[model samples]
Target: INFNDIKEWKAALCLLRSSPNLVELEMLARPEEDNLVRPGVSFWAESNQFDCPFDQLRVVRIVDVVGIRPELDFVKFLLANSPSLEKLTVKPVSNDGGLDLLKELVRYRRASIQAEVIYVDP
Candidate 1:
């Protein structure tokens, strides 16, 4: 997935929605190309609601996150929806704002009591 591709982001969410038995999921941002453009809208919005919980999802890994709003929102959305999630590992692009990003990630409401949010350095 490209960090700024709105279509890819939305499609990923839709795929997750349909994958009820999913266990481990990984989203890694490809290294940016010179032609990449930022999306005009956030892929996951606060007003949107999911019809079902991710009951079988146990692990999630997101890499090279730039700490953008959409990415953070997606993380929050996943945290809120994945009732069976046990671990979520996030690796940022760099150390810049890493602390703040970790704080924001931890602040989100998680559906699983045992879910642990892990922050990894670049």
Candidate 2:
């Protein structure tokens, strides 16, 4: 899913909300042109009205993350909602802000005591 696209991102969230039995999930962000303007609204935070938890989801992998607020919010949402999640891996588009990204990710509350957030270089 392209996190930069509001419609696509919303659709992805809707899919997640409906897929309570999802086990492993992966999101790959295709690098977009730098000239494009980023969305100003924090959709994840605003649309966080999930009624069901991701009970069966265990693993998740997100690639090409750029440390955007929306991306971070989405990660935080998943961590706080997916009680069965064992591991969530995030691979940045580059090493820039990687440490800060990792720090921010760890600050979010986790629903699963065993859930581990891994940050990797691209």
Say which candidate scores most in lDDT. 2
TM-score of each: 0.85, 0.89
User: Which residue runs of candidate 1 sit more than 4 Å off their true CA positions?
Assistant: 31-40
RMSD of each: 2.5, 2.0
Q: Kindly report which residue stretches of model 2 are placed more than 4 angstroms away from their true locations once superposed.
A: 34-40
The local distance difference test score of model 2 is 0.84
- Mark the 10 consecutive residues where model 2 has the least summed lDDT: 30-39
Per-model CA lDDT versus the true structure: 0.82, 0.84
Task: Provide backbone clash counts, one per model.
Answer: 0, 0
Model 1, range 67-95, lDDT digits (tens) per residue?
87777878888888888999999999899
